[model samples]
Target: MGEVTAVAQALPPWVLVVIAAAVGVKYLGQALAEGSEQWARILGPLGRRWRSRAERRTEKEAADLVALQRQVENLSVEVERLTARDKKRGEFEEKLREYLVYDANWHFRAQLAAAGAGTTLPDHMSFAQWEASRP
Candidate 1:
């Protein structure tokens, strides 16, 4: 009983309070540091996975854009080819019309010569008389 009482009296109240506070603060700091490290460990993989997915999405978008550009270029070439073909077709049709008109004129002239050679009528007959004389 005497030893316990002496020890209790030798320990100052202020010193005990300071020691308790220091221990509490040290434990709290250790707990906070450990918690922060654990949180980082848990979230590290998730952050890396999210970044990977974003990179894949960006690559897909870039590929799509490249494909679209290629398609547009192909379409433009097709349009140019079609325009050239149409222009050529138009020119061919115009030439065909001229050939047809020339052929008709040649046939008419040949028939007129045949009629003039077969008949004694003057070659100066009007179109109406020529039609009337046709058998």
Candidate 2:
């Protein structure tokens, strides 16, 4: 061990420095080359295709959303129109009921008079009661 240490110590310091520098440069170059190759493998033509596919999907989703929004707006307008029509129909039905009730009352009164009945029923009596009292 002592002899080996003496021989190592006698070697020129610049020779050891040069050997260390060569090994360091070799390893550095290898690392750089491997890193560049790995990057190329991960981010080559496939990256561009993936990006384009994603963009197309986004555009399609946006178009579908706009169409759905338009459909909702049209449905809202249709609902409003139908609601107004239903309201008007209900009012017309109420008026028709009133007219029918008035006509029936006058007809009942005239029939009682023709039958020579001294007592007349109130207009509010049910049709069944009026018919039962008829001669």
Candidate 3:
């Protein structure tokens, strides 16, 4: 190795470097050039088309999201309105139930009074007393 290095050092460094570069260029330069040419031919137009389509798709998605947001806002407003109406109806229904309870109680008292006043019950007691005693 030392002898080889001594011989190499005896020569001019640029000559050895140039010989190495020429050998590498002979073996690998053609493959590198062909690869670059194929890349330009096959991928250049396809890459442009792909990028344009991607941009258009993103634009469409943005538009759809905006429309959906508007629809959601409208639906939220409608739901709030309907809920308010339902609350009002529920209040009215509660009032109606309260009135019906009061009216039924009054009607039952009136019937009890009429039965007491209009008839003579047996055994010095009313029919209700007799029924109550049996149960």
Candidate 4:
């Protein structure tokens, strides 16, 4: 206590006031910085919550786009498959039309009956066999 008093008495009054002001300014700046940091911490979660929702929405949109693209690709493949099947069916119809024969006298039915065929009964004969079996 005696040493502190001696130091205070030795220093000029203006120097003491300058030191006191410097200490006060330093503490004030430190307090402001700490308060600003606390406010940032308090608001940080709210900012993050809004950002997270926006990010989730963006991700969902991207997923929907991918699913739509996949569906379009699947639809394109199905259309191609159906088109090919229709073309094959048309070709087969044309071939069968060429192979079929008609008679005005209707003797072709008699020929089929002569070849062990029956009326209203299924037969194990292919088109080529039935054509050949005509007597």
Please report the candidate that would top lDDT against the real structure: 2
lDDT of all predictions: 0.73, 0.74, 0.72, 0.70
lDDT of 2 at 46: 48
TM per candidate comes to 0.52, 0.52, 0.49, 0.42
Per-residue error (Å), model 4, residue 134: 19
Compared with the true structure, what per-residue lDDT tens digits does model 3 show for residues 19-116?
99988864454434334555334445644454455557779999999999999999999999999999999999999889868866766677778688
The reply for model 2, stretches above 4 Å from the true place, is 1-42, 116-135
Model 2: worst 10 consecutive residues (lDDT sum): 32-41
List candidate 1 stretches off by more than 4 Å: 1-43, 119-135
What global local distance difference test value does model 2 have?
Answer: 0.74
RMSD to truth, every model: 22.1, 17.6, 16.9, 19.9
Q: Spell out the clash pairs found in candidate 4.
A: none
Residues 22-102, candidate 2: write the lDDT tens digits: 999656554444445553345555444444555677799999999999999999999999999999999999998898799
* Stretches of candidate 4 exceeding 4 Å from the true structure: 1-44, 101-135
Sort by TM-score, top down from the best:
1, 2, 3, 4
Give residue 43's lDDT in candidate 4 (0 to 100).
46
Q: Model 2: which residue pairs collide? A: none
The TM-score between candidate 2 and the true structure equals 0.52
